[model samples]
Target: MAIIECSKMDKAINSLLSRQNYLVTQANDLARSFGNLTAFEHKVLDYCFSFVKAEDTSKQIYVVQMLDIIRHLGLNKSGKNYQRVAEAFQALNTKTALYLRTYKNGKNGIIMTSLFDYIEIIEDGKIEFQFSQKVAPYVFELKQNFYSFKLSELSNVRSKYALTLLKLWNANSMGKLNKATIKGTLEEWESWFLGSDNEGKPKRWSAGRFKQRVLSVSIDELGKLYPKNLFELTVEKSGRKVVGYRLDIIQPKLHCQIRHT
Candidate 1:
């Protein structure tokens, strides 16, 4: 692993992020969870996460004006944009589902739940919601130790693939780790990016198609985002067939600090 000092631009970004009000935090489990959200929906989800205070609980009903999300994304306030923000929340309600394995009383089972307990979009533009009880502990623990990034840093990431990659990178870095490597099988990579199908299976794509569409596009955008950093993707092969991927991100030693509010 190679270490580079933070560049001028990197320092500026860190400074700006330090002043921003929205820092999205997630436990590695939630970061690696399966979700099929659009780019705008992802932004909305992050915006909601930003409002979570250290003292907040899953049962706490948080409220935010829908326009606040639009403004935070640096979008012009328009009827169309408002509706877009509203619809994104609606999509998040169904699309951000999580299925986790659980064990209790010597029995093993699966827990199926969405990120939000419920989302109420009032006609007056106020949006109220709460995290599911099952997912609350993870969110709450993130304040102590978790991967976090500012929405300000990710506001320009237009591709869903790129956004997901950014989040995964932050998660895998484990806080101040300057160089992080993410290893996953082809199926796991697909589930992380393209998400599951109607039958609850990862969408199958030829290796060529998956690389061309998801990996290359995402890596290209991420390279632009962190020009001073290195984003390398190596394909793992079994004979002539692709089996998995190893992605390594090397950057400067600037500690990604998460502020507690």
Candidate 2:
């Protein structure tokens, strides 16, 4: 057997150690953002967490019941007004409803304050929302690394990519996914713009024809390909007319080998 190399092993070990340190730092930052909580705040957060996690029936019934109990409980007995408790309930309802609406609306559903409330409730009594300073850095990092990708760049690609990304983001955030279910949505879009004979039976348009029309209207329009680029087109038959063609990207791969002595 050949002698082992210490230098390579040492470099690999150092790289792994650095990665571990980074993860620890990230976790500590998140924990700090949660911060210490007051006893009353702890109870409220616990109720919120339980309210969200319970079964559908439990959540539906207990959410209102718990709020009423908290409002009238001895903790707030000193103040008969129960203004804060009322405010918390209203805020919770509004935030939850708004989150549902946003989820329904797709990418447009993101709201900063609602997101804060969500984080607050999920953390329970362990972390206070006041110490959110530590969380902002991580949020900013996430935005930079992931959310910052331009939607406009995506819009130019086939709608399929845009629709797929929207579905993925929704599934990751809300545990539910909604995709455009209307069959031939993309095909219909293509026919509206590039179909050769509007009245005649819809003919399956080639990718080259689609690209040509796109370039003719505006060279800057999205999904335009070079004249020389190789593309494959498939047309589907419809009862009355040809539906439309699908365009795909293809690139040639080259392989090379080297012999070392």
Candidate 1: residue 40 Cα off by (Å)? 0.7
In candidate 1, where is summed lDDT lowest over 10 consecutive residues? Answer: 17-26
> Candidate 1, residues 1-261: lDDT per residue as tens digits?
122433554565555433321123336767656447788888888888888788786688899998888889888999999999988988888777765556569644446677789999999999999998987877666533554677787798989999888878877887643577888998778777887666555567998899889988888887787776777788899999999999888875663322111
* Candidate 1 off by > 4 Å: 1-26, 142-144, 252-261
TM-score computed on alpha carbons, candidate 2: 0.20
TM-score of each: 0.82, 0.20
Q: How does model 1 fare in lDDT?
A: 0.74
Clashing pairs in 2: 34-127, 102-109
**Alpha carbon lDDT at 244, candidate 2:** 46
Q: What local lDDT score does residue 37 receive in model 2, on the 0 to 100 scale?
A: 25
Compared with the true structure, model 1 gives a TM-score of 0.82
Residues 90-203 of candidate 2 have per-residue lDDT tens digits of: 443332211111234332222222223333222121222321232334333333333322333333334322233222232222222211111233344343333223233333
